[model samples]
Target: MTQISIGVPVFNGAKSLDAVLECLRVQTFTDFEVIISDNGSTDGSKEIAAGFAARDSRFRLVEHAHNIGAKNNFLSLVEEANCDLFIWRADDDLCDPDFLAILKRHFDSNPELALAAPRVKFVHDDGSPNYEEDFQILSDKIRPLRIGDALMGASSSWIFGLWKRDALRHALEITLPTYPYVWGWDPLTLLPPLLDERVETDANALLIKKSISTARYRWQVPAREMWEMRRAFSRTCFIAFRQRDWTLAERVIVGVYVFRFANLRVYRFWKTVRAQMREWLGLKRRQRRSVEG
Candidate 1:
């Protein structure tokens, strides 16, 4: 069996798919398999992936007849993995050739590590530097963080990290059903890993995440959906609270985290309301001026 599995889920991502596949092809670590899942794309994404598979014996392509939603596609990729380690790679993202090598060394040496992630370097479409004005966060070494701190800092960056296949599978099986396909659902999908005490991160920029338009998670993907997701996430947290492993102090910290999350939601709702009100008032002013004229 392969030591690592890289699953790429694509839908009309032909434009950047080739570059991503090529990045994988040149990885310093070769004991890996690439599984590309095409979500019924008409934009030659399937052909691009197929071509890569043809050239690279390690690359495999899976095509779906219907367009399954993004969440399902992601979960399916994990389910298809057979290796001891797995990572969900975006078709539009680029990874450093040494990404797998660095992760492999750390994971193989550290039996207690549940998830291993590298520092993320954001780049433009043309491969130019992003965040030029801001100093990049650099890490000279890989280290583990407390579970609560990791969960608070969790985002899409950590979600793509290398995971122990069995741990990831169990996490997904427990968390996916609670995930609502709404705005900012990525962090929710990461709850299980974030709660694990053995998460580690390296400061090396082993992953280059391209800031594509569709890659950004918007907060406006239907209010009902957002509400449903928050509800589901809260329920899942309570379920987590019942775990025998967590201490009373840890459970209290989790409760505090949930409270903070609720406050964040309220803040977002007010911000949305204020923006809508401004738009509505602007429209009224325009209509009145038009009527007078």
Candidate 2:
């Protein structure tokens, strides 16, 4: 059995890490390794990973000297994984026991699929899922292409999709900067469009449970503050699109563009530009030093 490398990136995710690990243990597909890349978590999350590593030969952990930011942390783990098959699981999410098995079967059956994901079901921290939930944006299932239509519409966890190691690396080459950090990978999902890979939506769900119970993002401290922003964005869009107001709508939309389509589809142009500028400045400084030498 080939071991699939599951890349999990975490930062100060103590409260929710153990449950995910527990879920990982029960996975029906046993041939897999869990690689946790630590992003300088202050909490004892590393200890949690260490416990798992001690118990399971398939579990391994990597620590960053300092926090490499969220996005780079993800790339660092993905790039470091030894397996050709990979899936990204966040510290804040839970998986069904059959996740690896279902996904792997699709990988073996459809040799052409660059990306494959099983049905994704979301649950609260208490493991409650609502069938009536409208998950247009954050659900992980994307509209399939002509050939990939079978995997479309609530069929799979394509939202938290899986990719061939090489395919993901190539897509990252196209969409990711050499520099890494968090807060940017969401928008980069657009790279899948560029790769033209089909998503397998027909596979059974790889269960996805929300870690914190709330939609808070920072998950650092005073976490609810993150949700307040979400509530504000949702209200603003409601007032703008549904209420037919325009005065502050555009400004609000632009300001929180990322949160527009539920935070996954908005343009990261400005943020990406700012990141590039930092890289440029750093490179220029090094070049000047070399010239002076």
Candidate 3:
């Protein structure tokens, strides 16, 4: 059996599919299997995945006739994994050749560590460098503090990290049904194992995340969307409360962390509101002055 399984979930990602597969083909760590699940991509994604599977015995392609939603596609990859160690690879993201090797070393050295990931470096689609994230490691010895640390500091990209298959499966079971939206899926799924087990981040290993320039800005999002995001955060907090294994004090500590996170979100929301109000007032004043002149 392979030592690690990398699950690649693809949906209409023909543009970068070949390049991503090439990256995997040349990984310094060769004892890993790549499972690519193409979710009914009308693009040439299926052909690209199949091409890799044909050329590389370690790479396998699973084609779905219908487009399963992105969440289900990701979960399906987890279910298909045969190895105890697993990592999710997005169709467009690229990682250093040694990414798997570095992460594998951490898991081998520390059997209790549930997740190990590299610090993320954001890049444009053209592969130009954007900013790198200063990701805080969530390895606190105190379990409650670990939960708090995950709540406040964990990056969503950590979802792509190498994880113990069972821990990841359990986390998905807790997160997916609780807060079913795609907006906060990463942190929610990442929270459970982080609460109970160790997580390590390697500054040396680099995962290049593609930053889309045309995506809507935070302030441009509608009020209803913002409210739903807040609701998602609250639901994530509820997941902590549902942990029957946690002590009351542990639950309370996580609750305090959640409260602080919520307060920060509210502060940002009001700040955006004030900025929009000022812009509107200035626009109205300009119209009045033009009419008087």
Candidate 4:
């Protein structure tokens, strides 16, 4: 059995898919499989994936007849994995050749580690720098983190990190139900801590996230549709807080964090309402002026 399985979920990602696969081809570690899930792309993504699969036995492609959305596509890849360790690789991201090799060593040494991730940086399509770094600088050496620290450090950036397959599957099962079609699954990262799986971090190892470009735009969900997602994130936080056995101090800290999230949501909702009212009043005034003219 392969030691690691990397799931690549793509939807019309022919542009950068080749580079993504090429990085894997040159990986220092060989015992890995790349599972690509195509979410009903009309572009040349099929040909690109098929070509790679034909060229390399390690690369396998699964095509969907219709668009199943990103969340399901990601889940499908996880379901396809048959390895001890797994990671979700976005089509636009890049990893150093030693990325898997380094992370694998950490997992091999630490049996309790549920997740392991390297440092991350965000770059543009042209390789120009965008965000300074993807994750907070927690430490320089590999170290185990408390559940709370790990949960706070997990910026959905860890979603792409190496994970124990069974542990990850279990976490997803508990957390996925909390989220709907498309919104904040940020709380899902808290699953490791919730499931009592330890998390490890390596500030030196690197994963490069290519920031979204004009050619790679994401589908924007409307504001009205996002309330459920926001609530889901808060719900996930509460789930983690309740599931884990923490000290009274930790509970208080987590409680404050959740309360802050609720206040922020309320503030955003109020702002949205005020903006809508202004727009409606302006429209009414324009209609009156037109009638008088």
Task: Using TM-score, give the best candidate's number.
Answer: 3
Worst 10 residues of 1 by lDDT: 284-293
lDDT of 1: 0.70
* Model 2, span 11-115: residue lDDT tens: 888898998888877889887788988888888999999999999888888988787766677777777888888888888777667777777887789887666
Error of 1 at 133 (Å): 14
Q: Give one digit per residue, the lDDT tens place, for model 1 in 200-220.
A: 777663678876545233433
Cα lDDT of model 3 by residue, 72-141, tens digit: 8888999899899999999999988999999999988999888996789899767788888757664545
Q: For model 4, name the residue pairs that clash.
A: none
For model 4, residues 27-112, the per-residue Cα lDDT tens digits are 99999999999988888887899999999999999989888777788888888998989999988888899999998988889987
lDDT of each: 0.70, 0.57, 0.78, 0.70
Worst 10 residues of 3 by lDDT: 284-293
Off by over 4 Å in 3: 138-147, 216-222, 242-252, 262-293
Candidate 4, which ten residues in sequence have the lowest lDDT sum?
284-293
Error of 3 at 249 (Å): 5.9
TM-score of structure candidate 4: 0.82
Q: Which model is ahead, 1 or 2, in terms of lDDT?
A: 1
Off by over 4 Å in 2: 130-159, 178-184, 193-195, 211-264, 267-293
The segments of candidate 4 whose C-alpha lies over 4 angstroms from its true place after superposition are: 134-149, 194-197, 213-223, 258-293
User: Model 2 misses residue 278 by how many Å?
Assistant: 27
Top candidate on lDDT is 3
